[model samples]
Target: MLLLVSLFGCVAAVGAVGTHARLSPEAILPASAESVRAEAVLVSRFGAGEPHLMLLATTSGSVDGQRAATSGRDLTDRLAADPRTAWVRSYWPRHPAGLRTADRHRALILVRFRGDERASRAAGDDVVARYTGRAGPLRVSAAGTFAVLSESDRLSERGLHLAEIVAMPLVLLVLLWTFGSAVAALIPVAVGVLAVVSTTAFLRLLTEVTTVSAFALNITTALGFGLAVDYCLLLVSRFREELAREGSTGPAVRATLRTAGRAVAFSGAIVAVCLCTLFVLPLPLVRSIAYGGVAVVLASVAGVLLVVPALLVLLGERVNRLDVFVRLRPRKRTRSAEGAGAWYRLALWVTRRPAAVAVGVLLLLGLLAAPAALTRFGMYGDRLLPHFSPVARTSQEVRAAFAATVSDRPSVVLLGPGAARSAEAVDGFARRLSRVPGVRRVDTVTGAYRQGRRSALPPGPAERFTVGGATRLSVVPATGPAPQDGLTPEGSRLAARLRAVPAPVPVLVGGAGARLNDVEGVLADRLPPAVGFAASATFVLLLVFTRSLLIPVKALLLNALSLMATFGLLVAVFQEGWPAGVFFGPRGAGVTDVIAPLMFAVAFGLSMDYEMFLLSRIVEEHRRGASTPTAVATGLQHSGRLFTSAAVVFATVTASLALSDLLHLQVVGTGLAVAVLLDCTVIRALLVPALMQLVGRANWWLPGARTKDRGQERKTGRARTP
Candidate 1:
């Protein structure tokens, strides 16, 4: 009853808070008056189209997604009633479209706004008031990328219910089929589910301060289902072996807990640690992942270490055996999923020649990753929605029409302060900027300066007043064919020239383009740390698991190769735009964004997960006095097929996310799927075995370093020495 009450409390709190915060842009952005330019620049270029960001809020489903969206719409209608809002109305949709995913209770509505943040947010707040409860029992609010930063938190909330409904059954059925058991197999999962559900409720408390992205739904669900299923599988499989020997559930469960449980606890700790690395950056998105990751992992550990044993105590003999899958196959064949015995022989050949296998695998990854190099890092927003999407189509038309009216298309701001109200100072700066080559036009406060529109944000005196008031001058660059952020030489050149401005006015430049440039810088600075930290941690985890420092180092080295080769290829393909978007699937990138490093790091971390999982069994056999060759063969035979299936599952789910209308998610999902499939097949099967074989025992031994430790084998023989 207490548990039930707690659950009810959580649900109630989520609804109460969720309604006001879902998909709220106000939640995510660093709100400062000075930061308004980041929001304003786009509004200036897009005109009324800038308000389109609000659509993400409307579409996000919470207690009142529809009602909140309706409020935004109604406010828009009122705003349209004024002459000043005539242009804003042009971009406003009477009723925005809402997205319906697997569940219909959820939905999304799209909208647009004007100016930068000031104009847009002022408008957004009006829409928000109607949806923020107080009006009635229903608190209406949208949640998504732009509408809510807390969208992630809402997504976390969404996943809480989803874990029980979707993931639980799915995990149960999958485990039942995999284990062919009743209580023995399902008990661990039951424990894991309860623990994770409880932990997620705790996660809600975090929403008070930190922003959570909706994507966290995937994170927790994946962690909960994955760690639960994996732990239970390992424990129960061990129990089955022990049960046949001890002929008792209590002893078998105890034995399984002693061994597999220890491994699970250690492994879960490492994974939890690994995930915490995401918090190395100051970015809230990554930090949110850390919090969510830690909670689920801790829950998983608790389930495996505590709950499973309790379950065993309760269920007693019933927990010892079963037939969930009703299979007629012999039990011996069941233990070995892949044809790994044969592959083991193949691994021997590669062990004899590590360089050849390593090189071959590197070549393949290099080729596949080639497209990533030429990829452009663009925002995967509604803007990238199919050219036919209402907003996309509208934007295209708007862009074309504006091209005729304005001298410049949507572009950049290269800013510096100017000298007084002197027309000469503004004129000289404009003349120099106009001659800066890539610049289309350089407008100043001077009467002679012309293109269109009078200057409210003019140069000289206006710029001076701005400086005294913590404001600065802005020089808008031509849209042209330049890279989105300052990635290219042209962008670099523009930035450099603007920074060289001689006027006394203080200069601080930012826009979508500039912030994006900063985003890249942040990634570059943080990625190396992430790589070194994650890789070192992985190595330590493997070392402890195998009790062989060399083996862990080899794995680390191979992971490095896979990661770097992929990065090189990403640069070659995505950054360079090789094959011009063919490899990228439908939408082509001209130049990849800085987000790639973070994404790549994340992909590599997950790839490490499969590597650790599939290979641990083989390493275990080898440690138990099986010949290295025999161990490889037996281990692969046991876990190979399962690894492949899991990889495919991960890939398939990730692929589904790619189908999202949002380009950002689509790009992320695409890259993740590619990495997983590659790791599972080429990296896991062929290259890893081949490389390990070539290294022989050296794969698990550091050169010039050998402790005469217990269970030490001098060579590859079956004999072990203490």
Candidate 2:
């Protein structure tokens, strides 16, 4: 009791420390990327790379009217006066006709902040809270890159908190239903709490060394609890079974540790190994999840091994004593026998129709996975916010009011050293850029050029382009409809076209399009290595554990199939916007988020974790000289209840995240839940058994194994060949 109490207390201390973990999440571009460098140059030179906040001033009359114009100017003046603001621009002063809505009742106010992202966001939040609602003659609202993101952060935090609150009681209920004893159910929940607390502390420590994503908090808690419960379920269930057979505590624990404990350890290791692949991703968001996932898995494993065994030792046979819900009590001997017999019968049934079962399951999985070929990967924008949110509503109104006249923010291009900065060079480059298909205007330090015609530099901020022996150009694209992913088509085309332009110096295009392009490229570039690393790691681990070549190959293939099917569902439901009622937020971006592949890897690894459990028992039985068919049947009978129960708990915890308003979090949560369910039911239950039946003795075949003469082996009293 003292030890358990001390351990729990330690976890609490660590969790408190963990609360200080900093979240320094980045956007599409890493700081070192060329696009980021271009953005940095612009921000340093011009005091603005992009508008941090876009305040919309709306009125019942034309924005050009005296009343609305005066109010708009007042709002801009107040915004510009804020110490946190670097500068502010509005239609009333500069381009009233150009910036006004077709309906003439709304205008945009673009504001830039004067510091690093963290400081700027902190200061921007203050500005947004103060200025978002109302002003004389005009109702003011805010939504831009920064305002939208800030709102998302708040919603994500709230959603994560809500998920935890809702998931815990449901998890407890599932545990109670599964174990039939309140004491048995409570033990896993306790282990889950310890895992979450310890992982939080560890992640906090990790933050001191490197950056962590705010999303990691959500991932850590969900995975920590789910994994802890899973490992504990395996341990407690096996311990109970041992007690039933041995009629004592110590020996039961020892036997359970030798078998079920070993399986839990391997499963935990596999999960950790799978998540490690995320480290290969260049994105901070993906890497943080990997770090949190691995830490949580380890914490859960440690809690199960250290804490659960102690609980088992203390409680002994009494682990089954508390049955608060009598109707949920464990089945009698006859029922237990029937379940095992049913699994055995089920395995035999699959064996008789192995070919048909294999073909049918594959066809269903293939059809389910077909939509994944159409998957589009991009960043989630303001569209992910709830439709009723202030930011979301404001953004929609702003788009409706001003989208037709809104000028495309020019893609800023940075020139490398030895680049020509002379008037002649600048003129020649500007003229060439203006000829690019979508180029509306090209502004250089020297002057602004449009359609190959040179105009003297405007009286405003054009000269800010020259700095540090390098020069920049704002290549504005012709105005039109932007792409659904938020990168305007002209901007996207302009970036590519600008890159292709032969310039004397090297060029780096930076803006929304460039940032997204870099992000997509990085994900694609890193995907092969990440997938290779995950697959190779899984193969090596399974090979060592099972010592069979075929088993690892089959497991990998099946895991891939289930994951592919899940991805298809995600693409169809989230990207294609199928059955749209439950999918809150904007219509799909016509693509999954860029991080979907990473989620697939993580899900596949988790699926393999359960595969390890099932195979461990089957392999054990095989080595004990049980025929391959009997070994497979007995192993399924032994592990089906535990694996199914664990899957339910894991799916429940992850599925809770779908309630998040952040579409990215929703994708992760919903996708993970679907993957786990598919693995538990279709893959583990049906496909795995059928595959094993078809494969027969080859499932356990290792290199250099002699084929026993059945009669000779039996006559010699040696272990029968599998």
Candidate 3:
């Protein structure tokens, strides 16, 4: 056993060594979407794509002044000269009004890189590092898709390191208090470390075959420590309980594996199943999270089930040594005697007034969930980063300064064998696009148009748009830059309206706004099926485990309610930015991040983990000849502290994510913390007991089974397997 553990540790250590560097920071988008395909054509055929990097050059005087123009020209020349840059467009010399701020003190330079998303990000990083500070008379800062994503990646890595530093010691303290033994407490922490290392190795392997988002590293680490501690807590607690009863090590370990081991396996499988549902969503970010989440869960279960039992066998009664809080420790009691405990008493009280308790709890959950209806969804962007991030600050400055810039506008790509052959048709299409409500101007190969008229000849090289019989039109919006909150409702509507416009050739809309719109549309189409699969799969698993139709149905309903309430709170905290300065530091985009759906899937799985923990014991008690009410009370007595402790520990670990600079991470962390705490407290403590009491023996009903009298089973002292 020791040799096996050592081998596992060594393998994990090797795999984890450079895992962080292997991860990618590219934005999430569906590869097969029309917008993405348009982007590909622009990159491959036109030798230009959407600008991945933007440099804002600010001057104390007018940007048209000699000093500013010279500096700007020099900056543009440097960028254009770089082999990494596919193309560079600048305000200098040409003096396009749209690229210069209204006050004429700032100018924008847009740059596209020569390769894929990863290559673009790497080139953007190098460019930002080289020219972001100052060039001649201008102060330059980087902001754009790749620049912002790169900054977020750096900050996320730093934040995760800091979170681990802050979280681990606190988790250990909580574990010590819960176990009252320094030695036993360290055991779960060890298993948690193993889980994280092993999962990191798994993710490293994944990155070799497919793109894995750097954001997934956060989930991997958080779930690794949280779920490992949870599973080990159950195993260790059960082992100790069995030890006290059997007065021998071998039987105690065996019984622990039989009871708590089954729960661990089921809980892990359920969590993995829930995460796997994300595979149905086409977004790379969501799929990567699913991969990381499933990997960590499986690693955690394996570590706890194998290493923990081996340690228990080796340590025996000595597992209870080093009791740090011996003075505070309560006297050991039998499972039957524990019925007089607080949780058991609470359960009995809830069962006695089942209807009223259920009504009141449901009402409270309803009120908490009300805010979810008000949520507006948007893609995450630079604004979600910390205020101090240069990329975020630059984006804000660009929006405030420039009246219109190419970075925030959508591009229309007309594709065919002779799409650009007719100048009249191209001009007519450009004129109509320019007349759209939100459009400031439409620049095509023929010329530039504004408000249904030809405004000017093309400002830059027309050949850039006319490549291989394909024409690209840049549609600048009248509303300045795109909103900092990402794809706004207005942006989506504009994309739709533009797509509806008549065109002579096959047109594909591509740009930040269009990509976001496409993502939301795809999610809307795919989410229902993914959710249905998750729900049906979870129902089947619960039915098989509990062997009762009503129990599985009840569990599903309760979990859904808990998740709804969680989303409601998230909408309030993140979207509404209510109770400001408490959680997230600033007001959010007045919209929920698109990542919320991913959070929902993960949190639902976690809620079910606790549900299974409690129900497993309840089912065991019911099979052992106890009445419904008695079984509920006894189950609470046996498993209440176990899951509650696990929830608290899990909450503690996730709550540390609040310290992250990324707003999405903060939202995810705070949302999960709130969900777990609310689940263990109001939902599990009050709702489950009350609802089960109202249902009575019907809770355990199964089809095709002989109905036995409870009195007969009690008299015979016979137990049946669920």
Candidate 4:
């Protein structure tokens, strides 16, 4: 066993190196979407794509001043000269109003880097490194899709490292306190390390076949560590309990594997199945997370079920060595006396006043969930980064200084054969597009049009629009606050309006705005089926595990309620920015990140994790001839502290993400932390017990299963009571 573990560890260590380099930082849009198609044509035919880098050059005087103009031209020339640049468009020499700030003290330089997404980001990093800071007469700052994403990736990596630094010691402390022995505490940590390492290696290999998000690393580390510890907590605790009962290492190991090992397997499968629901969403970010999450779950389960039992066998009674917290640990109690503990007492109280407890907890959860109704979903932008982030600050400056610019403008690609030859048709379409409400101008192969009139003949390069029988039109949005990658509400409205306009030929509308609409549409179409599938699978799994119909239904309802409350809290904290000083996240962007769906799937799975822990124990007790109330209390006594410790450790791991400057990470961290805490304390502890008590024998009812004998219930009723 030691040799096998060591060999696997060595391979994992080798593979994990430079894993992040193989992962993508770019957002993956659906290829089936028209916008994506247009983008493909634009890149393939026109040698142009969305600007990957934006340089904001600010001057003390008007940007059009001779000195500033010369510097800007020099800056643009320098950018254009770079071999990495595909193209560079600037406000220098000929100042377009949209490219210059209203005060004329700042100008925009848009640059598209050559090559693929990763190469573009690399180019952006190089450009920012070389061109940022003061030039002769201007101060240049960089912000664009690539720049922002690059910064986010850097921050995310750093945040993950920081979280590890913060979470590990805290996890060890929790384990030590829970096990009352440093030796036992280190066992879970070792399992966690093994799981993380193994999953990291799996992700590295996964990247070789398909695109995976760099963000997957974050989830891999957090979930791998957390779930490993959680499963180990169950196994280690069960083994200890069985050790005392069986009075032999081999028997205790066997018993522990029979009970906790089975629960861990079921729990891991459920979590993995839940994460697989992300596959229904046509987004690589979520899909990558699904892949990483499943891998982590499998690795953690394997380590706990295979490696942990081996370690326990080897250590035997020595597992209790290094009793650092022995003084603080409670004395061992008889099975009957164990029911007198805090968790058991609380369970009894909840069962005694089941109706009142149920109603009160439901009310609290409802109130917490109220804010979810107000959630507005939108794609995030540089504003999702810290205010001090260079890209974020540059983006803010651009929005404040300029109105609409080429970067935020939607592009229309006419793709049918002979489309470019239809001059009159193209002219009519361009005029109609310009006439749309909120459209500032339309630049096409023929000329620039404004408000249904031809304003000017093609100014820069007509070849940019007409290439290989395809004609492109750039629809400049009206002057306003910058749309976040053209994915804001206003941007979506504009895209919809433009799409509604009559076209002379088959046209594909493409831009961040059009892409946002496409993405939202896909989610709307796919989300229902995905959710139904996950729910059905979970229900079936629970039913098979518990052999109880009402229990599965109850678990589903409780998980949904907990998730809704968690979403509400996310909306309130991240979107509404309530109690802004607490999380230290960026100011609210007025809408929740589109990542909410992903968060929902993840949190729901994790909530069910704790649910499975509690239910497994309760079912164990009930099958042992305990009455409903006694089973509930005894189950709490057996598994409550174990899962609660697991929740705390998991919460600690995820909550450390709040320290990240990336708002998306902060949202994930804070949301999961709250979800786990609420699940363990309010939902699992109070509500589950209360609801189970109210349901009575129905909680254990299974189809075609004989009801418990009345005489046996009567026989065990008194003996089971605490």
Query: Which candidate order results from sorting by lDDT in descending order?
Result: 4, 3, 2, 1
Clash number by candidate, in order: 56, 0, 0, 0
**Candidate 3: residue 104 lDDT (0-100):** 86
Q: Give the range where candidate 2 is weakest over 10 consecutive residues by summed lDDT.
A: 483-492
RMSD of 2: 3.3
- Give lDDT tens digits, candidate 4, residues 1-722: 86798689888989889887888886567567888888888888997767888899988998888888898999898888999888888897667787987788889999998877778778888888888999888999888787887788789889888987988788778888987788888887788888888888888998888889877888888788778778888888899889999999999999998988888989898998998988988788878898888888888888888889999999999988898877776687777676699998999999999999999999999999999898877778776788888788888777666645545678899877678888889998999999999898899888999999998989678788998889999888776454434767677778888899988778889887888787777788988999999999999999888888899899999989998899998888888888676656545667787766577677787888888788888888777678899888988888899889988988998898998888888888998899889999999999999999988988877757535443455577633433
* Residue-level lDDT tens digits of model 1 in 76-190: 4665553333243312244222232233232333345444433655455555444433322222343223433223233434434543464445545655566666765566456
- Tens-place lDDT per residue, model 3, 394-417, is 887876666355445788999875
**Candidate 4: lDDT of 378?**
77
lDDT, model 3: 0.84
User: Once superposed on the true structure, which residue ranges of model 4 sit more than 4 Å away at CA?
Assistant: 30-32, 62-70, 93-98, 102-104, 427-464, 478-485, 500-504, 707-722
| Clashing residue pairs found in predicted model 4 | none
